[model samples]
Target: MPQLQSHTIRYANPILPGFYPDPSIVRAEDYFYLVCSSFEYFPGVPIFRSRDLIHWEQIGNVLDRISQLDLTDQKNSDGIYAPALRYHEGTFYMITTAVRGIGNFYVTATNPAGPWSDPIRIPYGGIDPSLFFDDDGKVYVTAQQGADYNSHAIQYEIDITTGEALSEPQVVWHGDGGPWTEGPHLYKINGLYYMMSASGGTAKEHREIIGRSDRPYGPFERYPDPILTHRHLNHPIQYLGHADLVEDHHGEWWAVFLGVRLTKDRYSVLGRETFLAPVVWNDGWPHIDNNEGTVSLDMAVQRLPLTAPSTPENHAAIVLGRDDFNEELGPQWLFVRNPSDRACSLTEKPGFLTLYGEETGLGEVGQITFVGRRQQHLHASFTACMSFIPVSDGEEAGLCIRRDEDAHYELGVRRSGGRNVIFARLTVRRESLIVYENETKAEQLLLHIESTEKEYKLACSEDGQNWLSLGSGSARAISPEDFVHKMCFTGAVVGLYATGNGQASKTPARFDWFEYEI
Candidate 1:
């Protein structure tokens, strides 16, 4: 890609779409680097780089190594929480909490793209941790202390080089009586310290609030109202909060936050996406989006020299639009938890991706032979050319749109009544039903999953010319609102999956190519 001319641009909100939430951004070397929270997904903390804040390109993930994270048997939305990225001096630091695993930890890398140091554990017992480097060569860690409505921001001094707590944790700022006072970020501007946090939970009442004081801790004055929110607004975008501020090369302030676009039924399946808005400093307090107070689908702002991302040629960055599986799997691909080496391969079959069926299925905590990418758009098309032969009745391989383990829709090929059949199965809340099935004689099949705002249409074809509709699954069924006791923090992901149901299979499914388009 070439560099975009520096000029004012008209762009849409949610600059980086899909389940990218709790975004933290920093400007280094005239470039902006960002990281987002990835829960229960392997290769955690997806990171991106941009010359202009309006446009971003995924460079790599922050937690790509297994040693940095372990999400084994972790439930949906229960792995890596809000991650804060900061560039201090010459090293880049990323700190986060590993729910159901480590309490809190930080990683260091000279380069933001790769080879981060093994997680250095922080003895803190809270989520959404952030590191603030002060002018006096001092670093402080600020995070949320309790859970839900009882949560409050806590701060402690830490030696950034050794990850050692130099001071005891102390209350910094209790929120404005919101349900969840989390996602704390500390910054110093014009000699005064500013503490920002998201409150009122992360759903309908989500809003960003800020407070300021002359010192890093204590006696802070809160801005009277939320800096940003869409709580009671009649708009398509809702659930807005959890923001990080950045100053561009043009000396303009901006904020990157998380917000969701809802369907007609007011259900969000694409998860909380990253949105950008201009920030203004008024009387020492920051205001979001020129006092509009809420973010929208479209945003026109003055950009700082719009420049297209020039990703390094050697970097295995995600290529937008389609993937032919010609090279190694890009950084955008993800597995359920800690994946086994035997689960998938790109070298087993040249120019193809091979998935060996594992004994575990999607609904189980066991590692399944599955590989997928985030469903970044509400209306998108995903198709894969797969050659799978099921030898047993329970062995199957095909495409799946997974919100979690219990809630997903699978379109696969299985052996039924001594014949090969293409089936569409809908499983929600541990209940499975084969909604549609058709007998097929083809050895190689092209599986397609077309998603609208309300439904997902599964279809199949042998020649890639003639297609047959198998069935459709309701989009609302996989949404967060449909859950009873379960949580839905992560958004929907569509990808290729293979399973043996109970017993391991000798057969392997080969996918020639997988393409996802918006």
Candidate 2:
């Protein structure tokens, strides 16, 4: 493949930031399309499109309908895994694993943004599934199998139309001796089959390794060392791996992978993000990010001319930090697990989000009444105005800074001691504590949560003008570094929630507006 080396342009490392991990990219003509894992959040597998590789705008979600996605009772970081997005013969196919839902499946759509077909289940038992279409019209599927050191890449021939197995699955390649060989992407470049897979887990030891073979399923030759990694480097961006390669219109090669930005204490609250790096080929193998073998936050690289959308309709209107509840929720909003239609409504009160408290709370595994957007910046502010009348002690509705079920902070209005009060509660490792509580006589409350790199400061106001400072919580308490083994693959989400501890709430919580800023 030819490489572009005209002039260098400066761009940020993580083109798509905040919890967008296990990235897969493909060039479908002049546009480059990318998809990422959504985990337990509904509307899984967010898709983005860009004329230039660096800037991306979310077009829509692949799994938008409830009938297509069954994330019922899925725990945090367990719904949608690594999705391999590929465009073949006028159709865009996304194959992935729904860890606790339907195992392996692939969905198709003629247009990148629209109503995608229902998932066609693949009768396979593994994560990070990918589909490859050969020039001879043959289809192949690759996935990771086994465990730990025994982990390796597996492939099989299948009919893309019906998801039928045409050939028995075969082990194609074992990684470069790294454990947990997963997120495999198979490509036929220059008449040679290349298999790229991530290994050494998804932590600081993560790296991308490759191998090649003459046939689709064969005894492949390993690449000896990782093509892309920051495993031992003292860089701000760590845990780089699970990459997908694409050839641009100008015959330039580029890679989009997952990496995390760490604080001074090596803690990352932003989770794994999607990053871009230039790729060059020598002889037959590929090298990523030049000879430095690592990528940084600010990179000067050669890329295609930036082509931003000219019209307002074509432009991605992702809200930066504020939502006025004037229209239906946008693509950036997410719901925990598979939420019911009765959980939230926009037309009930008109200009207000009405959340009905279900028996299930955030601490449980079942679906709760909540809607959130990913915390994109380390230093950001999230504020919401809610009018909730809690008649019972367990009924509450307010703002939440959530990392997961067990790791979250809630600031809301609830009935305590037969009176309404504003409260701040923190839950870590299944232990819950009410840190601050004060009686509030106002019917409407404005809750605010300010996040710094080190900690999160919470405050509230009854009149939406004067604020009363609630206590703060350490950001490290919600960081993924402490709970990687417990499947903490998601970042913090600032959300509005209404939940009844063990019973259904009689009155609904009406949120007039919510805002977030960095």
Candidate 3:
């Protein structure tokens, strides 16, 4: 346990912005590593590295290959959950659960940027799995059990190499019971074991609670109140829980956690972003946010003497650069579920991304030839310059903004009645609507979704300069609950897509560039 003293070097909130939820961090000597869940997206958990917590670079993904993870039959937002990243001895361990298919698993690597080992499935039947290495050389695994989202957790010592339980699985601790006590992490401070868990749901009311025990698995004593929360603050950033504490090389403690950026109306498009806060040791327990017990938009910390990677930013927000298809895919690019080799390719054309139109469309239970990146900002403009000549009326190519499979809005271009036309389509679960349409003849056009804080305006441009408004809709229609009738843990993603309705179309949709900005 360590205390923090305020210093210079200002940094904006959300060290890692956009759809990076359930954050867990660990420090090893001079470097700090963090990982976040990927849900149904391929490349299960994204990993980052930094000398200072303010600036981070994506080194690699924990599950980047089909062998590491497979979300083949996963539901809309049901894939990987919370991950615990820790460094012990000379090995780095990442323990988590792939919800739909394989249950709990742990992967290891000597370097954070991997070539990580294949999934080592743990037979334990729980989610949000975490691990703690004790000074006695024994390791313990903790996870949330029971069927409901409000289920408590259980703990047991286990062998990380063999996945064998050294002791019987025992119900260890239940948090300050508001709801689900999940996202467990254990630490030893001053010879006392401190356990942390998240509760009160992962919505606006999310919170973090701490407890103490003499040993890893024990009858722990719960803290009287939440150590960190934004529940009653009436701020735009809510759902502040699921955190991991790490000590810096300076012996100062800091916390990295997940929080959503809610709009004025409390609707979130950036599902949950990773945020950092300073920690101070009170007696023995780590007290975050001084005595105020609330994480703010900005924090003061010790500035490490290290250079940060250049980040693209304007006064509005961070900018995701245009993908011109002149190089390989960036780390931000992702597919709906596990992507097929036939879905898309960059080498087919020198400066274009050729998306082979698939039969399955968005929000379907099957895979599609859609690749997207997480929509990071609320008020943003997303445009894709695409060229596709539909052989049949069923073939189409366009820009899509998806909440999940069941909930999404698409502004598409297709061949209709021997004429090229643009159409606006919206789907909320079983309900679907083609809200607007207009005729166009250009083989290459720019499809645009200009999103305000409250609404989205769909339009197109013959050239990148002149724009035509297709239609506009309220942002609430495409939120989590509207798509799948559940609180979707994921967020919205925007990118280019192509489909043949339900038939195979060998004619590919080529995208010259895809730009998303705030």
The lDDT-based order of candidates, best leading, equals 2, 1, 3
Task: Report lDDT (Cα) of residue 10, candidate 3.
Answer: 62
What are the per-residue Cα lDDT tens digits for candidate 1 across 78-123? 9999999999888999999999898899999998888899999887
Structural similarity to truth (TM-score) of each candidate: 0.95, 0.96, 0.93
Q: What CA root-mean-square deviation does each model show from the true structure?
A: 3.3, 2.6, 3.0
Predicted candidate 3 versus true structure: per-residue lDDT over 233-308, tens digit per residue: 7776788889899887766778999988777776777788899987867766777642263466665555543334
Give the clashing pairs for model 2.
Answer: 321-516
Q: How would you encode candidate 2's per-residue C-alpha lDDT over 1-518 as one tens digit per residue?
A: 87534666666768887888999999898789999999999889989998877767888999999878998888887899999999987899999998978889999999999789998988764889999999999998999888999998888988899998888888887887879999998999999999999999999889899888898775678878788888878788888999999997777788999999999998998899999988878889998842254588878876664454343432242357568898999888989987787889999999999998888988899878889988888998999989998888788889999998879998998876789888999887777889998888778889999999999999998777798888898899888776744869999888999888888887789999999777
Pairs clashing in candidate 3? 363-405
How far off is model 3, as Cα RMSD? Answer: 3.0
Number of backbone collisions per candidate, in order?
0, 1, 1
Off by more than 4 A, model 1: 1-7, 289-294, 303-320, 416-419
- Highest lDDT among the candidates is held by which one? 2
Which model is ahead, 2 or 3, in terms of TM-score?
2
Report lDDT (CA) for all predictions. 0.85, 0.86, 0.80
Question: Could you tell which candidate, 1 or 2, scores higher by TM-score?
Answer: 2
